[model samples]
Target: MSSTLLAPVLEREEYIEQAYFFRTLAERLREGVPAQMALLQIRDELLTTTRLPWAVEFLATELKHSGQLGSGMKRLIHYFTPFQAFVMTKAEEEGVRFSLDHALKVLEGEARYRSENPTPAGLFVYEFEVLARCQLGYQNGLDCMEQDSFFDEDWRQFIETVRRSMSEVEFADLIYLYSEQYIQDQQRAGREGPFPRPLFGLKEGRIAKASHGRDPLYLFAALQRQLGYPEVPRLRLPTEQRGVLQMLEHKVRELELRLRLLEGEVRGQVEVIQALGKPETAESSLEWLKRLDNEE
Candidate 1:
């Protein structure tokens, strides 16, 4: 929690533009756009004279030299939060299976939440899920999260607690222990010292209590179902995206062949007797292409 690393809570409009940047960049990257080009392309789409577009321009230049967007973002500590840069670095790590597209989507969702004045409970749950579901190490991940300006000293201490004990402790128990319900119970029991304000809401406490010892994902689902917390983005396989593109290409080729057949008929290249020999059926147009191949 170095003061040097913590950025101010950004303006709501800035977060709105940031969400757009992440979503547009992730979408273009899937279409084979280069990282530097993606940043460059998104500049005009952002609001004029804003710091985000300038950050994007610098990111584009830094990406050219270091071949890592994380390095550039890290340098702009005043604009991009440390946690933001950390995610980008993890996504770019060598020999890692984590996806950059998934990371970007996670960032976009976070920015959208921040634009709406996110609560600490909502932000914490959403970010913790990103680390857990993606298998990102809790130590460094919590270290980065603690540096975010949205959380104060109490949050930093709680995060440290979770960081040290997460391997052995149930996550729901931890949330319940730090919630407002816990503090209210303490007061009812006649504890006299001034108790610290709770970090989690009463509803969060209830969900955590119900989910104790169950799969922690069930807790996350409860939170999202009862509350409007943002859901964690699951990692989508690149091969699945490629398969979809291939399917679309196959359909396009089928249509092209059908068009060529119509053109042949107009040119009198098709024999009327041969055309009448094999009538059209409900089979795929690909089957029609196969029949045409056999005729030749």
Candidate 2:
């Protein structure tokens, strides 16, 4: 993919923090730590951090897209950068491989990808592609981890000691670095957005009244049904909906004018027919008789 497209994917800090978090959790789990405790720690860390909650929201979406949380988490770790990859245990590696293999099989069978065979492969291919990229990143991180210790201590061991040894402030800074690096990597990959665009569904216009008579609040509520609201405060409705209503009114007026024109034409035709049936005056009657004699 072009660097531009990859920039958005890689630029988000949350993706990086997630990689770090997953790597840490996977390592602890492999070493026999309770999964529930690991998850609780991760959640706690995110809540205590300023930027982490927003980042989690994005990660959650990616996870859902890669098929539920379990599959998504596996894919996330597998896709980490080379340095990030070293944190995964053998089991995590195996999970990633399985997900990747399944995805490739699905792709091979897809009609869009196959030359001789066609099937309604559905849109699952998109998910497969996304997961594949995540797995690739994790493989890269693994390669990096094998070369040298990226951090002062073994990352797996560090995670195991995190609760007892690291203070909230220290942990926050580490998380921040990890998040920054992840976002930077994504930026390097050309996965970040063009930036400065209003967040999705936050345009400055009023909800158009023509949209099923939905007010801005109602339209926003409808949007919430599809994409949950962002962490940001609620947005007010714009005046654009009024413009839409005005346009609809104009169309109605045009139709009424056309109807009047049609009615007038029909009325003129009736008037001509009624005049033709009227009895002729004496002068007109004499003229008609003269015209008949001339024809004879």
TM-score of every candidate relative to the true structure: 0.78, 0.21
lDDT of 2 at 163: 30
Runs in model 1 lying further than 4 Å from the true structure? 1-4, 186-196, 236-296
Tell me the tens digit of each residue's lDDT in model 1 across 1-296. Answer: 44436767988899999999999999898888987778888997899757899999999999888899889988998889878888889999987768888889989988999999698878988999888888777888888888888888788888889988888899999998888877777778988657656788888887888898899989998899998788987766678678888788877876766685786688775884257344353245566666666665
Question: Per-residue lDDT for 15-38 in model 2, tens only?
Answer: 445535544554555457655555
- Candidate 1 TM-score, C-alpha based: 0.78
lDDT accuracy of residue 185 in candidate 2: 43
